[model samples]
Target: MSILAALTPAPTTNETEWSVGDLAAALRRTLEDAFGHVRLRGEISGYRGQHGSGHAYFSLKDGTARIDAVVWKGTFNRLRQKPKEGLEVVATGRITTFAGKSSYQIVIESLEPAGIGAWMALLEERKRVLAAEGLFAPEAKRPIPYLPGVVGIVTSPTGAVIRDILHRLEDRFPRHVLVWPVRVQGEGAAEEVAAAIRGFNALTPGGPIPRPDLLIVARGGGSIEDLWAFNEEVVVRAAFAGTIPLISAVGHETDTTLIDHVSDRRAPTPTGAAEMAVPVRTDLMAQVDDLARRQGGAILRKLERERTDLRALLRAMPDADAFLAAKRQRLDLAEARLRPALAGNAGAYRARFGQVIERLSRHPPALALARARARLAAIDHRPRTAMVHGLARRADAVAALGRLLGSLGYRAVLARGYALVRDEDGLPLRGVAGLAPGQRLRVEFADGTATVRTEDGGPLAGTEPAPRTPRRAPRRAAKPADPAGAGTGEAAGEAAAGDPARGRRAAKAEGAPEDTPAARQGSLF
Candidate 1:
C-alpha cells in the first residue's frame, strides 16, 4: 500500500458518536502531521500572491491531477526566486486538510523554478520584437560627449551597479552625477526604472537636481530574469523618449538588453559609460590655447602684410615728376604769350633779346635741364633702391618664416629625417592611437614616396638615426572652446597648486575631488 494509503483512517466504528466538526478537525491535524516535510514535483496551474502579505496561493498539477498549495509569508520570503503560473517546480511542503471547508491544501516550505524553456522563448520573442524596431541597430547609436556637464544614472540604489558607477565617476569625471534610483529587476522594476528616467527628463521646478546632459542606464550583470527590467517596454520607451541622451550600460560586454537598443549609445560596462562621458580636462585646455594662439598669429600676419603693401606703394609713387610737370606746362604758355607782345619793338626787342641771349648763353637753360635731370635721376634711384631694399627685406622675412616653420616640426620630412605616412585618402598617421600594426600605409617625403608597413613595436628604426636637433615647439592646436580646460600642462599645474582646499570642499559636496584636469583646463581656456 502507498504511504498516503496507509495514512487513511482505520475502519470507522459504525456511526461513531462524534460531531462532524470535531472529527474532521482531528483528521486534519493527523494528516498535517503525517505529511509534514514531504516533497512534491508538479507544474503550476494557478498562482496568486497576496497584495498586503508575502503569501502565495497556487495549484500544483500534473497532466491528470491537481493539488492546492499555499506558500506562507515566511516561506515565500525565503524563496530564491519568483514563481509564475505554468512553471515546473519541485515543491517541499506538508498536506493540510481544512476541517470546516472539507478541502485539502499543501503548506509549502520551499519551492524552486524548473524547466523554463517556454519563459526563455517568451524572452527571445520579446527581444526579436524590440530588435525589429531598430532598437538594436548599431548605426542608431551615438557616442557620449567626452566630459559632460551632468550624468543621469538609473539603477537600483542598493545594488552593486550603483556603487560601481559612483566609484568610477568619482575616479573619472567627478562631476555632477544625479541618480534616479529604482528597482533593476522583477515585477514592477520596469515601471520603476521607466518612471525614474521620465523624472530625470522632466527635471521639474524646485527639483533637487538639474537635468543631466547624458543618462547612464546601468546594472550589474545577471540572469535574463534578473535583467528583465531593462528588457521591459516601459524602460525601453523611457530611454528612447527621454530628452537627455542615454547610455545603456546595463551589464557586461556580452550582455545586451532592450534598454541598450533604445538608448542613444551602448557602453559595455558602467565604468565605460563613465569614461565616455568626460574628457581629460588637461587635453581640452591645451586645444583651446592652441586655437587662440593661431588666431592671434593670423591676425598679426594679416596686419603686417597690409602695412608692407602700403609702404611699397608709397615708395613707388612719382611725387617729384608730377609736381614738375604742372610747373613746366605753365611756363610754356607764358613763353607763347611773350612771343606775341614782342612784335612792335622787334628791332629794339631783337637788340635787347640779343643782349639777353648773350646773358642766357652765360647761364644757359641746359643748366636747369641738367638740374631737373639730376632730380629725376635721384627720384628714380630712390624708388628703385627702396624697391630693392623691400625685396631683400621680404626675402629675409620669407627665410625666417621657413626657419620658424621648420622648427615647428614641418621640415623633418624635407630633410629626410622623417616621413609622413598616410592612408589612401591622404590622412596622415600622426599617432598609432587607433591603427593596427601591419596595416598598409603611404609614406611621403620631400624627395620621394614609399609605401611602408606599421611594425608591431613603438616607433620604427630605419637605416640610420638622424641627429637630434632642438626645434621650437609648434603653436598649440586650437579648438572652439578650451575642452573645459583639459589637456594642458600649465592648467594642471595651476590646479595642483591651488585646488587643495577647494578639492576637499568639492569632495564633500559632490563625492568628487576638485581641480580635475579637464575642469582645470576649462578654467584656463
Candidate 2:
C-alpha cells in the first residue's frame, strides 16, 4: 500500500461523508463515551461569579495547560464547596464536547478541595478576605442582651444540639425560643443556615412572630467536614451583619470555626450557648429578695435613729407653762395700767376741747367761712355768666354766617326759578357767544337738569319772537347789580340788581351763575 493509503482508514458504508455539525456531534458522543466519569485536579481560573442563569462558567487550569469547565445550575446550587478563583479542587464529572463552541469542556457534577492542605489554604484565604472587610473585627461585635425575650436558634431540628440547648435553657431560664430549622451538614446546608439567620433578623418586632433579641447558631460535635457549613462565608456574613446578638456553638470545644470569630459570643457547646443567653431565674429572684431585705432593714434603722434624736430634743426643751409664766405676768401689768392711762387721756382731750372752743368763740370761723363762700360764689357766677354770653354770641354769629352761605349755595338757588347753563366740559357758560347750532348745553332748572341744543344758533333756540310796539324813544333796560363782596358790606358805585318783572321773563342772562362756587356749605343738614 502507498504511505497515504496506509495512514488513512477506509470509510465505512454507514459513514460516507460527514457535515460539520454531524462530525462535531460524533466527536462529542465519542468523548462522552470515552470519559464518562473522571477526577480532575486543577486550580480554578477566570471565575468572576455565577451567571444570571445560575450556571457557573470557568476554567480548570494546570501550570501549563487549561480546559473549559461548567457547572449546571442544579449541580452548582447543591455543591458543598462552591468554586472560587485560584482554588485547587478535585472536580468529578464527565468530559464532553460542546458542538456550538467547537470546544471540549468538563461538566462538573461535584467538586471539593483536593486535600487537607488545599482546604486549609482556601479557608485561610477566605478568612483573610473577610477579615480585611472587617467582618471579624472585635469592635463590630455586639453585646449579648442580658435577658432576651426571644431566642432564635439556627440548627437542625432533629439533632441533639437543639435538645441539649432546650434542656439547658429550661434549667437556667425559660425563654420564648424560635427554632429556625436548617440542615446542619451536607449539600446546600450553608445556604439554609445563612438564610435562617437572616430570616430571623428580617422579622418585624412585635409582629405575629416576634423578632428575636438573641441568635444561637448551634450544632453537635462533628468532623471538620460536617461542621463546614457554619464556617461558610455566607453564614459568617449573615451572623456579622445581623442586628441580633449571635452566639456560635459549632463542633466540640477544640474545633474553632469562622462563625465563632465573627459571632458576638462563642460557646464551647450547645448547652453553653443556652446558659450564656440568660441567667438563672431563681438566683435572680433570690438576689432581689435579699436586696429588698437589706433596704428594709436600713430604713427601719434610720427610723429608729430619728426617733431617738427626737426624744433627746424633747427632753432638753423647757416645760410649756414655765415658758409662758413671764408672758402672763407682763399681760397683768399692762391690764392694770390701761384704765388709769385711759382716764388721763380723757382729761387731756377735755382740756384741749375747751381751749379750741374758747378760740372759736373769740373769732367765729362760720362768719369768715360765710364771707369766703360768698366771694367764691360770686367769682364762680361771674365766669359762668361771661362764658354763657360769649358762647351765645358765638352761636348767633355762626347762625348768621350759615344763613348768608345758604343764600349763596346752589342747592337753594336751584329751588328758586333760576336755571344754570353749563358747557359740555362742566364750566359755566357766562355769555351767549358760544351758543351754536347743534351745540349741547346743560340747563339746570329748579327741579332737575335738562340737556338742550340750539337749532337756529340763537338764545331763543326754538321760539319765534312776537313783534313789540315800536317805542317813541328806545329806553335802555336796566342792568343787573353785583352783590357786595365779602367784608365790604356794600356794593360801591353799582346799583342793586333789581328783580326781573313778574309779568315778563328774559331768555338768558350773562355773567351770572345760578349760585356761587362754594359747594354744599349749608346743604349738609
- Candidate 2 lDDT tens digits, 308-398: 9999999999889998999999999999999999999999999999999999998899988999999998798788889999998777656
Worst 10 residues of 1 by lDDT: 516-525
What lDDT does candidate 2 reach at residue 215? 95
lDDT of each: 0.69, 0.80
Tell me how many residue pairs clash in candidate 1: 22
**Could you tell me the C-alpha RMSD of candidate 1 in Å?**
45.3
lDDT of 1 by residue, 457-512 (tens): 34445543233343322222233222233323332233234454422332222222
Q: After superposition, how far is residue 399 of candidate 1 from its true place, in Å?
A: 99
Q: Give TM-scores for every candidate, taking all chains together and pairing residue i with residue i.
A: 0.45, 0.54
Q: How does candidate 2 score on lDDT?
A: 0.80
